[model samples]
Target chain A: MLPIATIVFREFLEIALIISLVMAATQGLQGRIKIIMLGLGIGFLGAAIIAFFTDTLAASVEGTGQDIFNAGVLFVAVGFLSWTVIWMKHHAKHLSQRIHKVGSEIVAGETSIWVLVTIVALASLREGAEIVLFTYGMMASGQVTWSDVFTGASLGAVGGTVVGVLLYLGLLRAARRHLFAVTSWLLVLLTAGMAAHGASYLIAAGVLPDLVPQMWNTSHLISGESLMGEILGVLIGYTPHPSGMEVLFYVTVVVLIALLMYRPWHSKAVVAQK
Target chain B: MRFSFPMLSLSLLLGMMTLAPMAGAEEPTYTLEIKDHTFSPETLTVPADTPWTLIIKNHDKTPEEFESTELSREKIIPGGGQVRIKMGALKTGTYPFMGEFNPDKAKGQVIVK
Candidate 1:
């Protein structure tokens, strides 16, 4: 794949996966699509603003401004996404029982669709700003023509949307009976992955310690920047090489959410009743 | 007794925060200049196997991403400003990087020897 296409495609795919997960999870909910679209609109606008002053933004925070801002976006998304899972458990038919089976009480999904909206916006903003910054960079360098960047970006966006469509359809059809199961689990993994990636950017910025620099190098096998690696990177935050802190963030997110949802003591009560 | 998860995790956080990077072990900081959409000293040589800091000063009034896949690092430097990029130790080789905003003019490389 050409570098331009690969770069654009990778970023587009990251946002696509997040959007698709939310779409599938909130399936059958009223007006969720409109909310998500509104989110995309706001996110794109925010991205344009950010892109316009990327230089100013990057120069802030003792020169780690972009990293700090991006990290904040990631963390906010993490918080809201976790809330989504808990909210769904209380609001959805299957999730309530599922939570009960695990000895946890569901919160009223009354948390407003705005939580999901914020997540969608933040996720879209991160990638959208990246696209703007990258394209502008290439444009200024004059190494690539404007048409080239535009075409590459269009193709990449389409490609990402195609995969997203497939995911949503597959969930709606093949997994109709288990939509709750699949989507809820997918949300958990996706959230954890986001946490891990956020930690990595912080590590790169020297804001976080590198407990262990390289857990292993799979770059020789499948580089993280490769197309497959990029897809996996989006779907599960997979990396060819991960630092110790990234692993810690990933595992902690997964375990923490699981424990919150599982409520072991309540499960024991459920088991006794059964 | 069941461990109070909140208390335990809080303690862990405090412990790690205490072990922050020491004031010493400072590496040499290198400088790169971006003027009129171009980088000065297009070829910078640094010692191999030594981590260093790069303070990129952009003289132009436009933003550029200081990106190098080879060095596995990418950061943006705004116009008429500066940004610091910390590159880990490198093996002896030439790693090319460029201004993502002005790829045509802002070209440069880090020569590790």
Candidate 2:
């Protein structure tokens, strides 16, 4: 039961961190909770379906299908996150003002709402699928009883969510004026991290070159399995030993998102200079 | 600074094209099998400073996640299934791996020399 809880907690931590960041970033958006809940529902359904087809997925594309599928999911999530950060940058001020005037019920256009939903769904689906597969395998092997699985899973979920809640609260405590800026930058890092992760999967699938496969190794200093490593990995895409291609993907996404969000051509200073 | 969207897109495309995989010398291959949650051979040795392919065949009745923090690789091997993992060149050291589902029982290492 302890081991099961540990594994589940590790998986859930990633999902929890992502959801909390999105939740904090979208604070005061009307019906955001319902939209996120819907995303969770969709993700849960998807996880079960993916687990059921794990064998087929593993066998496809000459045993690289799982890698390709994972890469696809991560890349899609990166896309949604990039869009959200940029969109929020444009409308955050107006949305916050409306929230204050309307007393906390501000609808941020349907398109943005759906974008958040998709982002939440993808995050959950990626982590949730692994949990489903692990538990299913444990059950099939008769190594653990049903009650133990339930207890461990519940404990793990609660433990992981508590950390995420703490993070959300910390974000809420930030100065209101700077909260959007902080969350937006965090999302940018998150997006870049996802892109780097996706690139690693493609490299694993032999679809992309690793470039310089071990640019550096810091595993002795910080093992990837450590709690700190897991949190940092989710927050900033920290890898103890990252390939050159992974670094390239990370930098590219960060620069691209920053360019899109700031849009220097539209800056007041640039326009004035022109 | 005027950065045209077209130029940005073009640069991005060019950058990605540069990442296209190059045909390299075939990597050495090693096989590891799992039965009853334990790895066969328990330790695999390979030449240092050369990338390799690891073929893991899980002959058990349950899925196992082949994980190695040292190698920075994680993948699931379904019951009675096999997977090919592309390992990076190593620097003459031991990289331990395990079946994450049964870490205590299923463990192995790759010795790069």
- What is the clash count for each candidate, in the order shown? 10, 0
Model 2, runs deviating above 4 Å: A104-106, A174-177, A269-274, B1-25
Instruction: Tell me the tens digit of each residue's lDDT in model 2 across B47-92.
Output: 9988787888999989999988788788999999998777777789
Docking class of 1: acceptable
**What overall lDDT, based on C-alpha atoms, would model 1 receive against the true structure?**
0.73
Q: Which candidate number has the best TM-score?
A: 2
lDDT of 2 by residue, A1-274 (tens): 8888988898888888998898888776888778879998898889889988999988876676787778778877887788788877777777877887887554687777787888888888978888888898889988899999999999998999899888889887974668888888898898899899888877776667788978888877877888999898999898999999999999999999899889886799744764
| Residue B80 in model 2: lDDT | 93
